[model samples]
Target: MKKDNANASLQARKEAATPRGVGVMAPFFVARAENSELWDVEGRRFIDFAGGIAVLNTGHRHPRVVEAVRAQLDAFTHTAYQIVPYESYVALAERLNQLVPGPHPKKTTFFSTGAEAVENAVKIARYATGRGGVIAFTGAFHGRTMMGMALTGKVVPYKTGFGPFPGEVFHVPFPMPLHGVRVEDSLKALQYLFKADIDPKRVAAIIIEPVQGEGGFYVAPPELMRELRKVCDEHGILLIADEIQTGFGRTGKWFAMEHHDVAPDLMTMAKSLAGGFPLSAVTGRADVMDAPAPGGLGGTYAGSPMAIAAAHAVLDVMKEEKLVERANRLGGELRERLLALKARVPQMAEVRGLGAMLAVEFCKPGSDTPDPDFTQKVRARAMDRGLMLLTCGVYGNVIRFLFPLTIPDAHFAEALSILEASFAE
Candidate 1:
């Protein structure tokens, strides 16, 4: 591949002009990506474990997704789902209503991003209950917007200096086994909050990541989901499951809530909703979603025709390829491998996750010292070896694995070998 010197020069010029608020403005630029592989402008190949931050569940440039977008583009690209009705939008919504967990009749709406989905879920909950407060969890990463940042639990980085956030958003503990916060203890914490702070009756919803994503790969205990249902039943608060990162077969199930045998009153989903295209959704019980007045839930590009078409193809790919089952198989293999590595390296503090969304945390052997330095070292070393990886958790001592469900077995093994070598170093 010939280097586009003109394009590269323009990119370099723009890099200096771009603001820092965009987050991931990586120094390198991708010339192309197919399946689970990415080639940079300079023609360096990388096995993409990041998957556009788990947005390419179907893999990069999947033929089905690409074909769908092309077909839709040939027809009409956008008119806005609200201003002009689109069959694909309605079809995707129907599919979501049917696929999202719960036996009850449900309704669905589309949004542009996960943050928008979350914001609308809260709005719908409050509208239905006629209440003001909502609850989230610590170490949770919702989004960057004010409302999202307010509901988010962390202080530094996300919530720092961006004070005076939206009120009525409370946070409770998410019981993490590695942290010794048990399910019962988390429930007690919620109880204490209800008694000391706003009454549960005034709370509109309790939103939780079925598996805490940015907070580390701590899977929420099944008992905790049951408890959340019980509390919601008692107070009539909606249970909003944020499945942004966990949905779309990243978890073994279509939705992570399936592991708990419970259903959210509302659910927010995005990331891999439309291959790599920007799309998100808010699906839930029909009545609650209907609570908000007409014209209450929508965006300029809420359900873009192109994204909806790609989403239809994505759903097709996930089902036809049986990616959910693949996620289960991949997660088991990953966990087994990580545990085996633990036996080899004592720094492997824990190996935990559901489906393909796995993580390996590191700490100083027997002590409680979170070895974030070690985690960063491993990440940098792995990146050097052409295997891209990411680190998360409050202490940044956890490395989350988000390989594409469609990654080839050969590439997967190669990435693992690189990871092992990095850990060894």
Candidate 2:
């Protein structure tokens, strides 16, 4: 084969010129991706464990999603819902209202990203309650926008030097079994916040990720959720479930909060909502969502026709293929396999998660010290063997599994074998 021209290696050249802020995950260039795998421009195949950061629950380029996007492409790309409303956007909303938890009449508004969905949820909640303060958790990652940075709790890369965020955003401890943040401790933190930080009544909403996706895959304990629900009801504050990373059957249930049997007044969903397309939504009680007056919420690209079409297709595929059920089956096996591996690798520490949204937390043996270096080594080794995985958690010592539920069993088994061998090496 002859050497290719620089024009043919645009991605590599572009990386050299771009600022480091434009962070890249895997170094390989994607010539194409399908189901649970990626093919690099050099034609190397990789088992995809990142799943586009949990935004490809149905997998990359699912046939149905592709056909839907292609069809929409022929019809038209954008007309701007605000300029002229489209049926698909409304149709998608109707589906979310029915799919999301709760018996209350629900309404939904679409945005282009998870951050936008979360930010708008806060806006709707504040407008509804006429309050300025809101609360989040210590390990939470709401987004990178100014208000999102304010809501996000981690300080290092996400918050460091990016302070002077929007005011009145409070933080409390998020519960994790491995860390022993019990329900009582989380509840008391809320109580203490009322006493020391801000009045509960002054707060409009308490936003949280049902499963802290970026904060290390800690499933919020059911008891903690029930307590949060009670306190929110008592204080007349809305419970805003941030399902940006856990919705669309990433968790065993349709929504992670479904496991708790409590209802949130407001919900923000994105990520897999559009099967890798840019689409997100804030869905909740009709009256609460209506708090934002006309013209209060919307963006130029909100609910683009292509994304709405893909979203509708994503919902259809989830039900048609029973991906929610698939998540439970796969997640159970993943957890069990991890437990079996734990008997061997002391670095594994603890394995926990719900549905397909699972993680293995690494800590120093017989100690609580976070083992970020071990986690980093595992990821580096995994990458060398053609497995693309991601590490998360405030401590940066967790390896999360976000493979598409639609991945073939053979591929999944192969990936697991690769992981086991990586550990052995």
Candidate 3:
């Protein structure tokens, strides 16, 4: 047997073996990765600003996470929590229940992916309220599943040919002042939706990302949140916070919802929850979570023992290393740098997001026209200089930074340099 350890070969194989729907951003194949850095099969090193799409808050293969998984590996891997439950799963649920917001008691259930968490959150909301309608915001991204796609707002790549999506799912504009959408506009739209589209009483949940993830890193306005909570209370509609991308200290707090005053009835979290392990959870008001029947919830691989163990270690590492505070510090520094760069880069339209979950939108110089081409150029230049970056937004004109919270200080500074050079070139 011969080992063909080349990125070109692997990329060719991947293209031939995989479908076109699964987009590949980087042309290189990863050979190894560590905290904030990865080497390609060609042995080229690149600073991982992508962070596995915001999954590696603890960085790749953190020693603590690795050790915990190793220990769990020796004991057992999977027993199907719904069949033979494990203590670690229960313990993790307990931890999440306490960590999630709201003064009332909470309950939690685990899933394998963020999409699964979103799907189950919807199920729980409908069961609890006995309603079938759901409201999501435009430019929002829930997931790739049928139900996830239905709840998602953007339609190009995520919903182009996948419909007919699940019925009774509605969408309203999300507030983006730069894009001319205001909070009042959003509220008025929601009001009109209730009047013209679906009755408020028939809506089960109003799901939103505290910081819109794939829709571009726009922070949900606090006023909007307060209004949503008020409306939910007024009409028995449950407010579901999709914290999958903004949870586990990526946003400087345990969850982005913490940055707001009101608490949601339910919250879906994943990505960084298990330090790169496949674990997602939905924590909500105890009664709301309990609405689903005993056998009504769960997955075959939900709450795997290994992922549960890794999640425990992720929590420990977060506390011991103080990653939450680190997020604020790093995010502040990045924000300052980007703001300074914005003065020089006329195409840089706006900088937004909370904590370390930051993004910069690109537009035609001195104009509102989205410049996705400039955004692509910046990403390409950064990749050429040994840095990885991600682009988002409905128009694909935004550059999102998702560096690991545990990134080494020196590496972080180097990535910043690469970023500045990318924009300059």
Point to the candidate with the largest lDDT.
3
On lDDT, the stronger of 2 and 3 is: 3
Tell me the alpha-carbon RMSD of every candidate: 1.9, 1.7, 1.2
Give the per-residue lDDT digits (tens) of candidate 2, residues 21-46.
66677765687889999987677789
Instruction: Score every model by TM-score.
Output: 0.96, 0.97, 0.99
Candidate 1 ranges with C-alpha deviation above 4 Å:
1-15
lDDT for residue 256 in candidate 1, whole number 0-100: 90
Q: TM-score for model 2?
A: 0.97
The TM-score leader among the candidates is: 3
In terms of lDDT, model 2 sits at 0.90
lDDT of 1 by residue, 1-425 (tens): 34757446756676699865556624467879999999887777888888888899899999999999999999998898888898888888899999998989999999999999999998899899999999999889888889999988777678888879999888888887777888888899999999999999899999999998888888898889998999999999999999999999998888898888889999999999999899999999999989988899899999888999899999999999999999988788878878888877787888888889999889998865789998988888888888888888988899999989998888888988898898888
User: For residues 1-425, what per-residue lDDT tens digits would candidate 3 score against the true structure?
Assistant: 12445777787789899999998899888889999999987778999999999999999999999999999999998889989988999999999999999899999999999999999999999999999999999999999999999999888899999889899999999999998999999999999998999999999999999999899998999999999999999999999999999999989999999999999999999899998899999999999999888899999999889999999999999999999999999999999999999878999999998889999999999888999999999999999999999999999999999999999999999999999999987
